[model samples]
Target: MNFEEIKSDENNYLMHTYGRFNAALVSGKGAKAVDVNGKEYIDFTSGIGVNSLGYCDDGWVKAVTEQAGKIQHMSNLYYSPVQIETAKKLCELSGADKVLFCNSGAEANECAIKIARKYSFDKYGDGRNKILTLVNSFHGRTVTTLAATGQEVFHNFFFPFTEGFVYAQANDTDDFKAHIDESVCAVLIELIQGEGGVVPLEPEFVKTVADVCAEKDILLMVDEVQTGVSRTGQFLCCQNYGIKPNVITLAKGLAGGLPIGACLCSKELANVFTPGTHGTTFGGNPIACAAALEVLNRVSTDEFLNEVRQKGKYIIEKLSTFPNVKKTRSAGMLIGILTEKDNAKEVAAKCVERGLLVLTAKNLIRLLPPLTITYEEIDKGLEILKSVMEE
Candidate 1:
């Protein structure tokens, strides 16, 4: 259908929740998408980092197609090769003792929160159910994960959010210390606050938090849902901090645009969940697992990771010189462009008009180009973004 047709039909049927953007994308090829009107766009958003290898990666498509033909899904009671293989790859990469699969970032984080609480419950009895999360952090939309998010705006309209969460200031050692109590069971953090304007947590702060968690015996959980699967130029963003977390949530790019979420825990928290403790029917479906396996195979390589780092540097270098950009911050391909002259939301919209897709995080223009994006495409996308910034 044409853009008008799609937009009209969508508005007629769909909920008006999102302030829908004007473009109606129809198809894409390797970091570039075309709208229904044939307007081409360099896709820096990558479906909000879900398309780790960009659109329609040949191998990923092949894996998904083959798996679908064989077995699309199987009940949790039955064993499936693809699911088992995906789990094996995740455990090997993350160094976590075991993993529990779910369907989205929210579910992954929900599972992590539960594991943290259950681990605490087995040891400390009651009252140690509180989870501390950093301020300006965004976890997920579920009630529990929403409660875990430290932002105030999301706390409203949903009365009586899950009550066991406490907020601590991000990177503020003093503020973090003040929020602690005997009831705290875990300290959840995002190494790089993706939704919070892509702010990287201070290394010293992470060290202190880790030390505190150890001293207090509170579980250290890292939310890598947006930063994992090689989005941050590493297998996991926590690797940059050189610290191991008790539990890490993984999603977004994990299943190559398919829905899959994994909550991995270290040896200590792994056994906290028994067979009947928790589960999900679609957690480890064969088709999603197959796509995820291919993504893992390609994204976890030495050469591919090195390229991601280089591309991140390349994008930042170009953005730093943009007319209105004040600066940029990031570790890898996850970039937050801080502009001095224009609102980031406006800049992102302008980029859409100029055939470039982008994202926004608070006042910063967020960019999550595919990990496999080439130098030529990066150059093209940057050129469009530069023009938008200057305009």
Candidate 2:
């Protein structure tokens, strides 16, 4: 019933995978959350970017609840109307031909890897299975994605990880070119390196990479797990670069608060997975798809996207007044606050104590406020962050 009692049960039942803040949240609406002790806090972490529409959005709740009453889940063996409509909307929005639904970012990326390797094999007849990813990239926590990840720190304790993944320097055309060979089937990239400190790639480098992929016929797979679903002020961050990728992986914000991921590819690679080639039982469940449809409807509008950009600018502008803030880097709502002296982890803990929810990416304090966050909530959260910096 209270904070202390809930945390006691949580510690006993939950795995110790995360270094949690002291605060325990209970209820929330929009960008505001209250703990069991009735303490309110501004939510800027957005459940690590999963809560795009914020906590229990009315439209999202209605969609999900209605779908739940009708059908919670159906196997892929059965046809689902909501799934079909959501897939159609995704194709229209991204210009991708088809979609394969999964449960999380890692599963979507795993599907992409399968498509790339199998496409190469089907076309060139085998041995071209390597995937090249940029350095400092974070793919996922799965065994295969962990191997595909470029950070060496993640490579340990997992003996005999998946083979055929190579790392290249980010934004370095020469380094990527040197690593690309006849065996390399695809080059997976993140437009804004979210987990690696919100680093955006150079425009010229992106253009050159696009050109190289076009010439070499290597599939350019863009990982939009954290930046997609209008989190970057665009339906897809690749739109900003004006480049068409062969495949795109999406998750995090797609289904508002529900678990859903989509791996969409061009028509050329759409047929790579025939029946029984790859699938999930819970993939494309009607309830999750219905929830995603609402999220997509709200986020995929020009006016709403513009508001995201404006609010992002507003948050950054307010943060500029903090003396300890060295710099703020962001594309839209996803932000990284570089501080002068404080450790991001410590500052984030203090933020929770001051009644705010924040996140950390490497040494930078990351902020992924709800895309539908009100200006009043933004001010509240930023004020808490400012006071933490001042202290």
Per-residue lDDT of model 1, residues 207-278, tens digit only: 999999999999999999999999988899999889999999999999989999999999878689998899
Per-residue accuracy of model 2 over 120-170 as CA lDDT, tens digit each = 999998799999998999889899899888999999998889999999999
Clashing pairs in 1: none
TM-score against truth, every candidate:
0.98, 0.98
Alpha-carbon local distance difference test for all models: 0.91, 0.92
Candidate 1 versus the native: TM-score? 0.98
Residue-pair clashes per candidate? 0, 0
Instruction: Please estimate how well model 1 matches the true structure, expressed as its whole-model Cα lDDT.
Output: 0.91
